[model samples]
Target: MNSLIYRALVELIQGLAVLMVIAYVMTRIPSFGDLLNRRLSLTHRVILGLVFGLMSIFGTLSSVDIFGGLANFRDLGPAIAGLLAGPVAGGMAGLIGGAHRYSLGGLTAEPCSVATFLAGLIGGFFYLCKKGRPIRIREVTAVMAGITLLHVLVITPLMLGLSNEIRQILKAVLLPMLLVNCAGVALFFFILQNLHRERLNEAEKHRIDSELRIAREIQMGMLPAPSRTGDPRYAVHAVLKPAKEVGGDLYHFFVRDENRICLAVGDVAGKGISASLHMAITQKLLKALAQSGEEPAGLLERLNRELCDGNETMTFVTLLVAFIDLRSGEAVLGNGGHNPPYWIRRGDVSRLVLEPGLALGIREQAVYTNQRLCLKPGDTLFLYTDGVTEAMNAHKELFGDDRLKTALLRVREKDPEAICRGIMEDLAHFVGQSEPSDDITMLVLRLESKEDAAAGAADGC
Candidate 1:
């Protein structure tokens, strides 16, 4: 009995050493450190602790040859613990369990104790390394082979040399232990792979959500408010609807002085976050150059140069800038690969087409020229992004330019705000039952004579 007690105490010490080694290796792995930093909830940590504690107790029993030496399967529990709490916890459990088992039996020999400790240490190491990650099939096979080799070479000989009874017991238990360990490893890997995939999907969703919020704010800021007054001669009304969280459309109006109103509309090439960011930059630069009293053509030329200077990405913007002289009722329009504006008078419509130039950001030396239009009393001007004309219906039919022109002619006599709303409604009707595929923006301006304004105010109230 005394001899048995001595052997058991020695085995327990060996088990402890095994646990320490496993813990050390687990802590050294980068992924294990990352898991710890994620700060798993207290409940999860407590649950993992309980699991490891139980596995350690089982490991001790296995070492003592209690319950017919099948206690070696206790390693499976620690392997599971390592997979959940990471290698450190798993390894510590294995060591403590192995040490307890050794202490409870008289198997204190160097070979037996060392072999048991190594088994626990190796099992814990693999468990921690595979925590919250998928295990490759090849890696699983390799780990199984390595464990088998360790048992056959070190464990078999040690038990056989110790005594005939010990040899027979170990021989009977070894195959079963190997099968259990292999299954545990396989199960841990399966769980880890699923968890890793879920984590990646969640991370991607969070990133997209964050980007959408920023893009929405930038898009809203780029638009001109309904109450903004650029010049009293013209009442401007603009609205934008993005098909996605953010889009490439942009519009801005600034009163350079009492006499001059600077207005611009632009569409960046593409959609979503990248396009939205480019649109914001383009809007800011256009506003700055317009405020400096630069001619419409000169502003485009400057913008092209600024955009092309150091930009590595092949992004371009179609832009139209106009300077309206309220006193003379004349407007100077400039184009940089943009759609022409529509001029509406008494239900008759004409497009103000300018000489098209390269889109902004393509080349620094690209030039833009201006076209002049004289605004007639009660005449309206319409500017829009391509989304309006290119919208597709449920039947896959495009709401073409002809349809847009007809809609504008029908609503020419309406108020600026009403005209914009009318056009949007018409487009929606045309594209029945189909979701918008791009950013839609419309800006309508009607030049009212000072005499009509005074008469209109007097007629009202």
Candidate 2:
């Protein structure tokens, strides 16, 4: 009897180890995990039910048989199926395992098969009662204990073999089977719950990634492509490198007419999705107002009024709008709580000085002034967001105005695109491997010679 008890316990342990491996492997397979999580069709449920039913048969075959194959922990797989996958799955597994047990044809065969069916019924009952809620370990232990007692009561009275051998086997294996099955159920359910959680988390991540990708595409589409602005006198290029999937920085240029070109760059107070949305709204407003040929200061004033109308978010944008005359090279630059642009000419660099007001969406009825500057042939007007000057290195050092001025002087590009690319390269080298903390946006516009402008105008005609 002692050896029987020891061997039963050892068999139970080995069976549980195999069950753990099976559970782990199933979790790794996407189809199995999806089916268990109820994400698949009824066909998948039926397939899994059949599979787990076979697993119960396998558990029994692998266990130690004693007293003419009277008792074992064969019902573990069926119980788990019913509890985790609900009633239909449980019933299928129980029927399959029970059929196999009857085919073995022992004294305890009928009783064992009956016990398997009862195990499935009980598990399914509990699962139905607690729909959509995680089952606790204590609840599983209680169910297993009840199933074990029911098996003992039914089988002990009905055993057809010599009474003494039946009693000895029952005494040896009953307690061990109960202990093993209860522990196995708890471990198996816990793993199932964890796998469900992991699936949910992965699904959520995929959803967020898809949304960001779409948002990036939309944001890129909103800005005008710098390569072709439909003007020949002004060679213009712009770049916006957002630190995140979307950002608040914006730049736009449009030739309002034959003699006037409108240029604007703005930065919202924040970053990421919210900022990107605000920037889009600002761009639409600017484009709408630019069509009326509003001067730089008037345009800023009208934009501020529109933004502050229902500004519950309290977000603001610092903007710079400039109008350049294609024939005479006259620029009217307006500053609205934004960084002043740099004036580049004859190998010299200086910041454009302008009277400023609060950023848009802050104060209603805010007024602005336009500062005039005359651009000569070969003169370049460079505009940027704060992200350029405030870029930080690993040591917490900022790439300030001085470094930017030096970069501008060193760039050899006569075209706006090459110059913008050169400055971006310089900024990346300065930051090294440190991630940018903000969106970096830059726009360059170089005025061409009057003679060249005339010749280009003739070509367009």
Candidate 3:
């Protein structure tokens, strides 16, 4: 009797391994989710029922010897169907398995058949209780335990006619069979629940992706046109690549008054929706404040105070702003903890001198000072954020100032668009397969006459 029970436990384990694989595959089917979550068409519902019934039929065929009679996890198919889906699929699974058991024709056959058929109803009662929600581990365990008891204690004795000899056989077989079937059913349910969770996680991932796309759109739209033209004194072009979480990097060139156009480049301290909002506010405030005819230093002084006034978050930004007179080459610029621009005079690249002040909003008392420059026709000022110098490679190497200066040499005698794109391409090649750590932004503003513009255009400038 001990040897037979041991063999029976091994066989039941082998059968349940196959059933768990089948249950995993079944739950992954798109139609199966519709059966659980939405109203299925009659044709789909029947097809699903037939598949569950087939699972029950397979269970009956894999029966093992327990004492003198055969035992199998045949009822688990319909019971799981009722617990996961609803009554119809459960009842169908029960009918199919029970009919197969009855055809085998033993003294215990009628009782086992009745119990198998009722297992589906028992599971269906819980399905109605949960109302299609995923069943909890404790609840599923309790339900399986109750179904096992009904088969062993209530239905079998009534059918076989209670006797001391028959009761002794049942007492011997009941414990092992109950434990084995409940374990098998629990393993199967575990696989199906994982599939349900994965589906929900995939849905949430798509939702975040959709919202990020929209936020990026709104951020880009806030900038002044990438190529701006007011008078023939200067032309502006810029390029920007935001990090995965959009960062605050901004460049704007707009007519400040009849004789001048103001240009500024700024980078906020952080990334994501918060930084994007800060970038938008900075651009709007600059455009409004520039209209007051403030010079670069006055604008920075006032902008810093405004940003610091209500800022409980203590977020700050690096900025360089310049006001250029269209009729003359004279320009006045100011810096607030920003990188100094590269002054390109007739194809020569050199760093422009600008003393740094504290970054805006870092301290309300921070003062920005004016730097003066005279631009000859064909001279350009290239402005960029530190993302250029600090960009990392796969080997964790920085694309430092020396490499940037070398790349800048190649951009000379080129137009603003070419200058921006060429450096970006070189940066991408150097940083191959490395995730970007910060936002990159570049702007090219050149003092040009009609004759200079035509000559620059001829050389692919």
Residues forming the 10-long window of minimal summed lDDT in candidate 3 = 452-461
lDDT (0 to 1) per candidate: 0.70, 0.83, 0.81
> Can you give the lDDT of residue 133 in candidate 3?
65
Residues 29-122, candidate 3, lDDT per residue (tens digit)? 8877656656655665466556777787777778775545666777787787777666776787788888988898876788888988898878
Ten-residue region with minimum lDDT total, candidate 1: 452-461
- The TM-scores of all predictions, comma-separated, are 0.66, 0.77, 0.91
Measured with C-alpha atoms, the lDDT of residue 90 in candidate 1 is 55
Off by over 4 Å in 1: 1-78, 86-184, 230-232, 292-294, 429-435, 452-461
Compared with the true structure, what per-residue lDDT tens digits does model 1 show for residues 1-461? 34543454455445544644454455456565456546676555455545565655655454445324432545554545554565455556556555655565554333444554455456557756666564584576456546645754566575546466655555555554565456545655554555556567878999988979886986797666854564566788888888888988888887888767877888899998889889888988888877767788999999899888778997999998888776666788999998888898777888877898889999889988988887755777888888889999988888988998888878888878998899899988888888897888888787776775435433431
lDDT-better candidate, 1 vs 3: 3
**lDDT tens digits by residue: candidate 2, 1-461:** 78788888887788778877887887789877766766535676577678879888986787677777545667877777777767777788888888998898876888888888778777878888987687887888788878877777554556554477777767777878888888888887788778878888998999998998899989989999966555557789899999899999999998788888889999998999999999999999999998877789999999999999999989999999999887767788888899999999888889887886789999988999988887877789899999999999999999999999989988734678988998898899999999999999999998766687655444542
Candidate 3 accuracy as TM-score: 0.91
- Runs in model 2 with CA error above 4 Å? 1-22, 35-73, 83-145, 157-183, 393-397, 431-434, 452-461
